[model samples]
Target chain A: MTTLLPRAGARPPGRGPRTAARRRERLTALGMVSPAVLLLLVFFVIPVVLAFALAFTSARLISPTPAHFVGLRNFTLLFQDPVFFRSLLNTAVFAAVVVPVQAGLALALALLVNTKVGGTNFFRTVYFVPVVTSMVVISIVWMFLYQKTGLVNHLIDTFSLGHLHGPDWLNDPSTALPAIIFMSVWQGVGFHMVIWLSGLQTIPADLHEAAAIDGADRWARFRHVTWPGLRATRTFVLITITIDALRLFTQVNVMTQGGPLDSTTTVVYQAVHTGYDQQQTAYASAISLVFFVLVLAVSLVQRFLTREKD
Target chain B: MATTPTPAPGPRRRTLRRIPGHLLRSALALLFVFPVVFMLISSFKPDQQIFADLGSIKAFLPVGQLSLDNYTAVFDRVPAGRFLLNSIVISAVTVVLGIVVNSLAAFALSRMRWPGRRLLLVLIIATLIVPFETFALPLVWWVNKLPWLELNGFHLALTEGWLDTYRVQILPFVANAFSVFLFHQYFQSIPKELDEAARMDGASWFGIYRRIVMPLSGPAVATVAILTFLPMWNSYLWPLMVVQDENLRPVMVGIQYFFQLNVSWGQIMAYSTMITVPVLALFLAFQRSFINSIASSGVKG
Candidate 1:
């Protein structure tokens, strides 16, 4: 809001002392900023360039050759790998299932709490407790709950249905990824619910009052008034969910280890395995680069979709 | 803006009748708390009893078998005390370093006029899009090349292996661009008039930031601490990558070993409950401020 200073409008007629002080301020600013800048450059920017370069090379984890350029060999291998294809499919399925389910649950919880109801704060706090709980702990606890003789099976068994034999939820390929998705949604819904609650509050009460005066029902008010005002928050939630769903790691790693038949092995998990276990650093980097591209492209699509809606 | 005085609703009032939304809310609240309650109760049950009878009221029944067996087993099996200590230290160090660096950087970025300021802001924010996984390989390569970290580097460090040292663990995490950006937005939102007035009083930029801006951004500081602590404590991949020594691993990483121990379900639940209790308690204590700051800060960007 302040205007740029003009040279001739100086309160004092001299520029030497002021210019010296300005130089000193500039030096101090640079001094304060350099540590953060240096760290970022060394850790983030430089490493990314190196990683990008390493993608085109043949670098094993413990090899001494320092990675010789191998052109598109790593990239080509990534495309043809059956496991990579499986991971792609699995990740797609996981995202598709988790995002909508979590979003719906979050919205429902938010709506429930946002009502003119007593003990709304209590419900909000209850749902949000899991959000702060460590994910690794949650995964470990859930892994027990999903064990062969775990509590989930016990519940299902009590139904006494002849066809309802419970499978090993973590080891079973059909159920492992879906089970992880379910846990992720349950743990994550609270954070977004809070976001949506805030968004709901931002919708002016007068709008609802006017809508009621027009004989609009609650559903109509939500559809026409609430949803439109919540566009920005929805966009934020959509992008965040997309990003988070792509970064899915702890649940799979802790519970399944992408196993039974590599059914739950996502790109990140596969990359960790390839790089750490297989010692194929170049191959892992290549896989990671592709995964990175996929995440970016999908997230960009999410951004555009929300932008169009807005 | 004209006001109309309306009579208060009487017992026979029809238009202002209250719905049973309160009851529905309580039901929803129960739904939310059900799993947590299940977890708490299950932690106290016998191992064999847990999977044997889960859904029925038999699961929730009080048992004379309830004891501290699971907790003792957890502590005995893993170095639970050490892991908790390491977690607290690392998270505290991260918060302290993160606050000092980020707040200073934010002060410079917000208050000082400099060339490439906008460019710096863009570069900082753009880093948020890059996943940490992408940076891990190259970062490890770089960290391994550090002279002080190496056996024969210029520091004349006698010890050979610092690979799993706390320095290696904490250094990389302390320079988060997200925290810097958070502080910047918070600092920028403070009116420029404050800084100008401070300057008029002959206060240096550092003095102004220390005496004025920093104190004004208390909520932001809390937000930063909580946000930073959550990820730092919850961090798994980075710790797994760097820390090979079982002794140095944090609680989250240590909890992963509970699976490998082939522990009983009740014991495992007890361990999960144990580690999560502190975090849960902290959340309960700070939920109001957490929600308040988040709602107001508008960091959705």
Candidate 2:
């Protein structure tokens, strides 16, 4: 919106002066924003540049120096390494499953509350509590709840069903990542619900009333009135969640430590493990570089789709 | 045309209007509150009780199991007091410094007619899309180099550690890209006439910002503080990397021992409860404002 601003004297409202003022305005903007621009260069852009450089060298943690140029070696190693491949596969599966499930749940919750069905404010507060609580604390709480003889299994036993025994959630190789994903969904669903609720509000009440007047059912009103208004909100939520899902690390670190045979070791986790634990800074940098590109790609694709819809 | 006001809703109509919707809404609210209710209940129960009797609704009945032992035991095993202080100090300092720096930069970007503003604004927004981990290591190295930039001549040490210093932990996080973006967005939203009128009265750039822009942007500042504080307090990875000394760790990091140590469930429950209550209370106080900011941002397009 600041783009609407004129340079100092554009208030005179003439032709040549306005053009010259625009040029000067551009320069003045550069000077004004230089501090932030410089900070980003030093901290964000520069680090990314160094990460790329480090990917080509053997810069181990202790060594501090680029020991030697080993072009494509780290990248090649990542391809051949089974752990790297598995981490990638695990991340993809996690994102693919969790994003849609969480979004869908949020939509359902938002609809229920938006219609003034019951205690909307109370329900909103309850759903959003997890988002406020620290992830570390939540992870620990869920860890206890997911233990071998934990509450989940005890509940299963009450059903008199032998097949539904809950395993040690964080300890089992197969279930560890999935368990973390479930916790993430629980924590994350609220934020999306808030966004969807806002979208639901923008949907004019008259549309719903009109649809009902025309003998439309609940689903039809939602389809024709509610969903159309949600397009922008949906796009924003999708991009934000995708970025968050792709960058999943905290839960795995706190609960599983990417364990039970490394089933939960995401790209970010592996990068941290490589740099800190294994002391392979260059390789870790390479992995991080890949993760960065992946995030950028997903963000760009979402942005493109959003722009197209607009 | 003579129109008589309608009588207040009849008893039968009122009853008919309220019953079904009230029941469904209450039921839905219960589902949302269930997990939190479950959490509070489990916190009071013994570890063995949680595991053994999870199936029974009676397991959560807050009759005899409610105990203060866990809360007291938590205080015994950890420096709970110091952790709380650390969280308060860090979050308070970050919020204050973050507002000052971001507002200054945002004002400059919004009000100043300078070059490269568009490019700089784009850079700020772009940084938000990327994860903070990308900058973590390199920023650490940058902070370590700060001491060398002092009056003393530079020396080539392979590694100059700034580990465990509040400066190291806090300085790197001071210049928040999101806050700058948020402030800029808000400042732009304020009508230029308010700024122009102040300037017309001979208010300088700084004068205009202080008198006109600052007072009008109260909601924005509150939004910035709430958004920034929660994340700063809950943050773990950056704190873990920077603070080698266990004593300097924040509450979130300190709470990790509840899992790692072979502590009793009472202790664990107490620590977790302590850590969560302040946050839960904060959220309750600002729930409407919090949701309002998020909703506004999301739907603005």
Candidate 3:
């Protein structure tokens, strides 16, 4: 797309006496670009700076009284809050469970459907149904499905010959977060499967044929070639799953609302809870700052762990 | 993993080996789709029938008395039509604006030389790392204090706060970093010589972007559109915070309204099905582009 040679009808290579056309190019480019740049500045950059600044203030969501700087107050209170701790723990537990399980399962599903067989499209489409469906709908549907006498429990009981009884999935403290996690993975895995399938396509057929000719077995070919070939996709799947798991607000918001004694509380959910519902803007800002750092730290750690190790 | 796209004609029994794999995949696919299948089927049934059918595989089948009663009742119980309209307006506006704005910005960044182009590209990409949730809370407060101009008593008035409006939902999501990046990557595939050739003909830069570059970038546009539309249409958390007016609420937030009042399960399924089916239809229609767009997000970004 680029060339080192001088462009045809190129302007003279001098700083002085720039052409009117050249001047217009700069203006045109800026004019074209400024709308997006301005919007990002207002919506993204300013809010990020505000997140940091508002953390140390006592601002309310909508208040008549002006906010003043409150040094370490929000952080101190956040450290003491059991709900905050639970949210943090729940977030970590989710990312840890989801990153491996989702990524591995997606890769397997991708492999299963990557065959050049008939009905491959059908299988791919079915696997991706959840990805296409919105999370809110999925959550609501699963809310019914996860009931003690819902379809899931009914299936379990039938499979176990009527000996097993299921508890309320969203109501019980122990099962609430896990239930959400299960549904989240079920909704999201198809997406990663698509990514893996694409990655699989990119691995040239000759490489696999050559490996097979060299007497590699099924698992050996996968372990050596397919797995290694998916390094970039693997990194992507892991990082995305982790980030999404950390930013687990919508499902919890829809299904649990951080309920069952705050057992399903997530960092993002807690931020919204205090920020909007509780109208404690400053406190939420502090939580947001910490969350931003946690995401940053986890991403860097992932990068370090997954970096080229040759 | 067979390397061949098509299997060879061999011993007749060789094809039988694939049956087990096919069966496994079909079972896995069934597990993936059954819940949505159940939802779609359950939407047509009454509550008592729904509960009765739940104990058997009939829960996922429309075997019982099926009718449009739940759909009709959904309208009476809540403003399902209004919420769907609001979501369509918001998501459609945001996606259209996002494609146009991000592509233009990407064109400028990729095609033209400018003083701060490199720095600007870097800056835009940097914003992608900060997930929206991190700034969502502050963004609520920030948008509230922001000003809007509206016609008041036959004259334009400076109004404070963008809370409870369509623009609040649309504008913030329009200038997406990922969309701009996708456009940039896609534009790079188009030959720069086309731009130079068009410019040599006394065409304006915007003319090149419009007449030449953009028309050739249909794939990029589709990818950006799908990616943009999904999140905007599925947007829940932001609207929950910023939008308080019922009329301004999108479907995701509207679903919450229906979720409350202890509604019947049949009605909830009906509402869920109503909101979801259109998107699912779009997915089926544009499955290739949708899959590619998602894959590009993973592979490139």
Candidate 4:
């Protein structure tokens, strides 16, 4: 709602030559923006409208015949279908777990590197290496490590924790989603850490100095000063992570293919599966519309929660 | 205890306190770095040795029975060279076009005074919330019907569709909302006096952008370029949906080609290494700018 609100007019009153100059400026602006506007209209705006329209129809991708509208049927079917509900639940659980865990770990890492330590840049770079690597590549690498006789289990055995045998990570339904979550957190924490680091740097040094002068310990300083400063950044990280978690597809696609019993099936993955693999275009469109609504709702809630107090 | 004067801690005590923090940080950093390292090292080792070395830290070490055999096998199994070339071309073109188009739009919104600019910006920013997954199917259908100019055996011919081509992979992504927003933000920070001065000297709007604004926006350009290149390089879902031709498939789609029944671990590692090395190199080279951009934009890589 805030982003959608129009700003009050700021143009100054003028006449004659100024009006002509203003027209020229407007024309120039139009010329500059037309390419991007046109592209967005074609690719984003129109497609979104079409997606909404398609969700109401019984459309099949491969069918030659024209499709007919089936009002509320797709949504009704989605609600009734156990697999659809399972996917929704899986995505919800994934977001619930990963968002906080990833954000917390990232904050911790940011605090660690924020200390005036030697070679902090080197560690920052090292942590961010996984972030730059493609998700497909990371998933493939992790798939190898998640094998039964894989490096992960081998390491566990070598470290004298042999009693706690590592389960076949991606293959076992019980551990599959959690395994992917762990890998995702590992890959994503660096990104949030960098965000937190920037937020940490923005906190005025004088505030910390004053807190120390007031006999505050490091823990007290962090709780009172640092946490307050990072409220917005924390909210941003939380929402972004939740959204990213909901869209979990590449890992599931590359590693598990939503299998070992669909433990890792997410909304986006299900949409892709239903639409592309099953050719249930209308149903997939419905699923996507629901997802879009969920995302928008969450973002709105986050914005409301983080809005500045009057 | 209050009456006693405590001696200041020596340098040794300070060093001792720092050692634990440094060690812990290093260990955690190593945890993140190990997978990529393992991928690189495993690519050099043969399949048996990769498994043999798995029990110890040697799994991450580039030692024992090392050869480029897996690399050779990867090339044989998948068209590694073609995939790499395709990805580079797609990513490069997307980055270039994205910079030009998005920056122009941003300049309009941020610099030129015009009616509806605010509304236009809001609309552009609003699109950021709509994830591509939500509308990808519709986009596919639309692009399937879109026109293209194809060079059919050196005779330029009009085509009805944009599918199964590099343009299909690149065009949709070139007009990025986030990039436009980022460039807009960066442009706002530049002083308006510079633009006004250029205009006073009889410079056109395009000339002002080219000579005055773009020249001073190196960091912004770098950030947008890096951000644009990343998604294009790692594009998976779009290409998968639109492209069925193996020749036009990006490196990400080529990854699925290796996911056959007999899972060749070494070859997988080799293929991953090949795809990942360029990204790692790019990050290493633009480490500062990449971090700065992400930090400023609050965008995840």
Encode model 2's per-residue lDDT on B128-247: one tens digit a residue: 766877655544444444453333456554545667766665656677888888899899999998867876686666777778888889988988888778888898877866676766
| Clash pairs for candidate 1 | none
> Candidate 4 lDDT, tens digit per residue, B252-289?
98887776636578888888888999789989998988
Each candidate structure's TM-score, on Cα atoms with residue i matched to residue i, is 0.90, 0.86, 0.95, 0.93
How do the residues A229-300 of candidate 2 rate in per-residue lDDT, one tens digit apiece? 888788888887887898788898888888889899898888877876776778888888889888889878
> Candidate 2: where are CA atoms >4 Å away?
A1-38, A64-67, A159-163, A305-310, B1-35, B41-53, B137-159, B296-301
Model 1 lDDT tens row, A190-299? 88898888889999999999999999999999999999999888878887787788877778888888887998988888888887678687887887787788778977
- List, for all models, the DockQ compared with the true complex: 0.52, 0.42, 0.79, 0.63
Of 1 and 2, which scores higher on DockQ?
Answer: 1
Residue A2 C-alpha lDDT in model 4: 33
- Top model number, DockQ: 3
Clashes of 2: 13
Alpha carbon lDDT of each predicted model: 0.79, 0.76, 0.90, 0.87
lDDT at B14, model 4? 80
Docking verdict class for candidate 4: medium
Error of 3 at A29 (Å): 0.6
Clashing pairs in 4: none
Model 4, C-alpha of A146: deviation from truth (Å): 0.6
> What is the C-alpha local distance difference test score of candidate 2?
0.76
lDDT (Cα, tens digit) per residue for candidate 1, span B1-301: 1353665556325333544555666666665555566667778877776655565766656654677787888788888888888988998998898888888888888889878878998888898888887757656655655555345655545443336878777777777887888888888889999988999999998898899999999978998888788788888887876677887888788777765788876777777777778877888899887665544433445
Ranking by DockQ: 3, 4, 1, 2
Q: Could you tell me the TM-score of chain A in candidate 3?
A: 0.93
